[model samples]
Target: MSLAKQLSTLMIAAVLLGLGARVATHSDLPFWGHWEPIKLVAPPISIADDAMAKPDSAFAKSTSAYEVNLAATMVLHMKRNKSNIHFVDAREDTLYKAGHIPGAMNVSFDHIDKDGDKFLALPKDDLIVIYCDGGDCHLSHDLAEFALAQGYGRLAVFTGGWAEWSKETDLIETGSGAK
Candidate 1:
């Protein structure tokens, strides 16, 4: 939401709230409306259609979205160089303590949101690779979104994350700070 829209909403809500504070409303009025999932019917898709729109990995679970970043590329980057790229482990503290990508920093989504400067303290132009528990895990995505909004460029999501990464290699560790 934009600042102006949010301010307008707050003002209108404040007025309604003030009225509520003065008057005794009935209990019959529901505060929230019932919500149901909306069914969407899309036209049938074909390989040619998707290939033209966007090309994903061969093994990728048929998504119409952008391609997933190659975790091997990140692992290779880590193995080869240390300055251009940085890794963030967006998992719980305990899970992070168990094991994480080598030189990965335990900066959970909450941590980044609370003190973005903690991560922003680094060079904004450097590559930031974020990961979580791999499949269906969105913590890294959320953090990446936040970082991008805050003007950090050269961002990549290790979408395969730790699950896919750990299976491929044993370059895991326990701790904070990047190499």
Candidate 2:
């Protein structure tokens, strides 16, 4: 056979082998789950007409967990010092220590056994903003679902999470749970 034919045959065999391996593997490594675009519910237009306060709205009434954009998270963070809004970092303690939203509390979804009390202590009636490592990270989502099941009425997930927050602003807190 010519060199060109040999090369073609090798390429086809490699492709088939790869396909077979992919089919046999149980883990979804190469492709993460379905690619549903993150749809962030718009933040309240202004403090005066705060949609957050009105739980009767369509989005609010439909789901217990609301997906918020970066702007909403930032606004809540700024007022965290004075307001009832609580920012819960769903990432692990190590990642939480590296950098997290200033004033955010680390209650990792992975370490719920250790941090469940801290999470439970927060006022369920108040808005709890949970976030993790952002894109493709399900820690925040899992935590939010757990919170909702535990009777936390008002919950918001900053879909962008730490990745987006760190990139967009310099407002980061580092240390072992000190902010």
Candidate 3:
């Protein structure tokens, strides 16, 4: 082809590419562009030093139990031995009142201070299974940290939480005031 025609084609391609890049970086371009700003948010900081200061540091430091994915089977096991284990729902009272794991007790983190003294009201030795709304919720982490601070050695966070529990058709469920 002619040199003029080739140059014009190249310029057009470059302009189209630039426009596409600009659109991709803009947040107003519908659902696909909404996540652009999230990529610019700050990264996570390390918590090793903060975790080391707790009395229950050994338990809190290790994420093995804290991070485990507890499915419906584990919930069923805990339900069978309800007397030995305590199901602590860490969601807010409103969510708790809406619906929660059957036989679970509400312990809203908003009520507990940073010192975690309020959680001491419960028996320390009980096998505590902490849960929140679901995998995305942070209430379980808040309650587990509080419980650990209060000197509870046996604590397991059911990361799947209410969402996973609700999926089980065989599991029993009651209204908000089951306890």
Best by lDDT: 2
lDDT by residue for model 1 (31-130), tens: 4698542211123223344332222222122212122345443433444243456677787777888888877777778666664656777677565667
Predictions: Cα RMSD each? 12.4, 7.5, 13.2
Two-way TM-score contest, 2 vs 3, winner: 2
In model 3, the runs with Cα more than 4 Å from the true position are 1-65, 72-83, 113-118, 170-172
lDDT of each: 0.60, 0.77, 0.59
lDDT tens digits, residue span 1-179, model 2: 99999999999999998888888985455465667533334343333446544423413422457777787677777766666778999998999999988888999899898888899999876777899999999999889878876777677888889999999999988987542
120: Cα error in model 1, Å: 1.1
Number of clashes found in candidate 3: 0
How does residue 44 of candidate 2 score in lDDT?
30
Candidate 1 accuracy as lDDT? 0.60
* Per-residue C-alpha lDDT of model 3 across residues 134-178, encoded as one tens digit per residue: 767887877777566556665667667788777754554555654
Better of 1 and 2 by TM-score: 2
Please report how far candidate 3 places residue 119 from its true position, in Å: 3.9
Model 1 steric clash pairs = none
Segments of candidate 2 deviating more than 4 angstroms: 1-63
